[model samples]
Target: MAATIPIGPYHVALKEPIFLKLEVEGERIKDADIKLGYHHRGIEYLAMRRTYWQNIFLFERVCGICSDAHTTCYCQTVEDVAGVTPPERALFLRVLVAELERIHSHLLWLGVAMHIIGFDTLFMQIWRDREYVQDLLEIITGNRVNYAYNTIGGVRRDVDEKTIRLVKKYMDTIKNAFDKTVEAILQDPVIEARVKGVGVLTHEEAKRYGVVGPTARASRIASDIRKDDPYAAYDRLDWEMIVFDEGDVLAKTLVRVYEVYESIKMVNESLEKLPPGPIVTEVSRFPPGEAFGRVEAPRGELVYYIKSNGTNVPERVKVRTPSFMNIASVKPMLLEETIADAPLIFASVDPCVACTERVIIVDSRTNEKKIMTFNEFMIRYGRKRK
Candidate 1:
């Protein structure tokens, strides 16, 4: 006989709200179903209502880990619609901040994974190194999380020589600390036993499911948006896209670990190649048109679509985050894995439910559409408590 098991909607292993329904026979999972929409914030609708300038901040809140990527893509899309391009210096600066964020995001995910596997010591050590990257981000962008650095045409601030020097100093420290940590993790026999063959997603399944980022790379799908569609200073820099053929948890771990080194190198290169001149290109008006923009976020490809109506406000705004695509692939990964490994397998994808959530209600008979705030929906649909 098979039984259904539920993990999350709210669980310790989940970073945000998501529901997983697993059908298990004995200890092995037979099938898995994923449910989302618990964390919807109506971001797209809000973006349409706010001015183009305001949308930057709005979109930045899409995901705290990928905030800079969100603003970068949103600003780029708006610039595309308005027929404007940022300065050369600004492009390099974008790359610098983006790579730094990537390092921090990967470290954060790694630390969380370690904790899920009951390796608290490794988790603490990884997070301690991650703090150095956060300090570097704060030094460069002012704020650690939502940097608020990107604007319509270019970045809001310039990177001075002193700041550049600080970036170099911190990158060296972070790289040294990170290398030692990686050595410790790779040498740990327990970690090896736990993650080596668990949650396997083959190359064919990866391609068929259309996963991205380290998850896809770990499966030998060498698809990187930075290399595939060059943007910012990525084309100018020399960095290799990390790939692995195993398509297992260990492969995923190694892919991220190697990518952190790649991100560190990219940051240093961007700083050395940082050019002179203005950081922004001012645009006073936006023309009527639709444009799309994307970036290789820490998680994966983050896409933004903007439709401008010759006004300050946008006509429509749509976002397709990487988690939205990657979360579904978890179904295939969970199949045949033990229930004990479920959380680790799920965490391996680093799903950001907040980024993936969006809700738009439509009436069936009249085909009427409505968008409601969280409070409004909760008040109307709240189950009465006895």
Candidate 2:
């Protein structure tokens, strides 16, 4: 007989509200199903109502960890639709902020993973070191979490000489601490025993499932949007895409740990090579057209689509976050794993459920289901007044 275990909607191990149904026989999971949509905010519908400028802030709230990535992709898509290009200096600044956010996000995810494995001491240490990156972000962007750094044509702020020096100083500090931490994590016998050979997703499965970011890289897929499709200063900067062939939980950990070092290097280089120019360009009007933009976010590739109608507001706004792609891969990872290892295997993906929600409402009275576009939903159910 098989017993079904439910983890989430809300659970101690989960960071956000996601429902997982695990069918287990004995201690081994026979099958798994993931359910989302509990955290949907209808942001696409909301974006259609707000001006292009306002949508920058709106999209940033998609996921606190990937906030800057959201704005970067959103602004880039709008810039594409409007036929504008950000200044060279702004592009470097964008890369600086982006890499810093990546460092912070990976560190936060590492801490969470450590905690999931009952390694509270390491979790505490990792989170403590994460503050240094946060402080560096605060120094540059003014806020640690939602940086509000990106704008329509370029970044909202500029990095001065003092800020550049501070970034360099902090990068050195972070790298030193991070290197030691990585060494400890990789050498820990308990961690190695727990994570190695667990939640295996082979390269073929990774490609088949269309995983992205560190998940795909851990499987030796070599699919990074920053490298695949050049954006901001990524093409100009010198860095390497970290890849591993193990495709297990430990591989995922090592990939992220190595990428942190790469991110630090990219930040330093961007700062050293920071050019001189205006950060933003003025855009008078948006022509009627549609454009798509994407960025390699901390988790993976985040995509934004914008349709313009020769107005200040977007005619349509659609987002497809990397979590949407990576979360599905968890189903394959969870199969045949123990219930005890479920949380760790799931967390290995660094999923952001709130960032993956797409809402659909069904009328129970008639058992009728209609997939409506943003415009249709607005016109049909939107509040009306005389």
Candidate 3:
């Protein structure tokens, strides 16, 4: 007889609601079937209902963790369709905010990973340190989470000398702490016991599925939208992309940990060389056409496709978040791995469902089709298992 283990629609390890139907035999994951599109907000569908300016903020809400990335992509797309270039200073500041956001994001991921491994102290410490970046961001953009920094033409606020100095000081302290955290993570025997050599993905397999971000980099794919396209201030900054040849959970963790340092370096460089000018350009009209933009978000490459019909509102707006692509690789990774390691491996990609600002879709082979909240999933699963 075939045996099955149903893992949430609600599970403790899941930070949010995601249904993974796992087919298990003798503690080995024979299959992992994913059910997404359950939390779709129809944000893209709302583009037709709002003005260009309003939609920027709306899009930012698509994924709270990856909000700045969405804003960056939205701004770039608007700039392209409007045929306007932001001030060089605006571009630099954009990079500054992006990198800072990235630091917090990766730190958050690290904490979550630690939490999954029953190390709550490390999780708490990582989040506590990450708050510094959020504070710095607030000073620059007026809000920590949804900065609304990226307007149509450029960013909304300019980084003043005082603000820049504050950021520099913050970065200095953050970098030291960041380094310590990474070292601790890499050196911890418990971490290696759980992560090292677990959940491996080959470079060829990663590339074939068009996996982006640290998940792909851990596999030695070395594809970063920031380096490849040189968007925003990346071209001006002096930094290098971090990649590893081992496609394991350890490699993914290390790739993200190192990226925190690279981001700090890139942000400090941008601030030191920050130019003077208007942060935003007034874009009153957009020519009818299609424009696409992609940004290197915390999770991976975030892409936006926009179609304008000679109006202040976009006719079509589509976003492909990195989490969407990275989530695909989970199924392959789960095969043959023990259930205990599932959480660690799942978190390795740092799947930010909210990052995609997508909806969840559940289709079943059997006649039973239902959607439940994360809480509901857990309650039902616990009851069923008992």
The prediction achieving the highest lDDT against the true structure is 2
Q: What value does the lDDT take at residue 25 in candidate 3? A: 81
lDDT score at residue 118, model 2, on the 0-100 scale? 94
Worst 10 residues of 1 by lDDT: 377-386
The prediction achieving the highest TM-score against the true structure is 2
Query: In terms of lDDT, which candidate is stronger, 2 or 3?
Result: 2
Worst 10 residues of 3 by lDDT: 354-363
Task: Give lDDT tens digits, candidate 3, residues 1-386.
Answer: 44777767678888777788878887788888987755667676676667888999898898888789899999899899999998898999899999999999999999999999998988898998999999998999899898888888888887778898899999998988877888888789998999998999888889877899999999999899989987887888889999999999999988998899899998889988888877888888888999989999999998999888898878778888898899989877888999888878888889876554343324566656665543465465583222
lDDT winner, 1 or 3: 1
Give the Å shift of residue 236 in candidate 3: 1.0
Pairs that collide in candidate 3 are 36-360, 36-361, 37-359, 37-360, 37-361, 38-360, 38-361, 39-360, 40-359
The better-scoring model by TM-score among 1 and 2 is: 2
lDDT of each: 0.91, 0.92, 0.85
lDDT score, candidate 1: 0.91
Output candidate 1 Cα RMSD.
Answer: 5.1
TM-score of 1: 0.93
TM-score of 3: 0.92
On residues 213-243, what C-alpha lDDT tens digit does candidate 2 reach at each position? Answer: 9999999999899999999999998999999
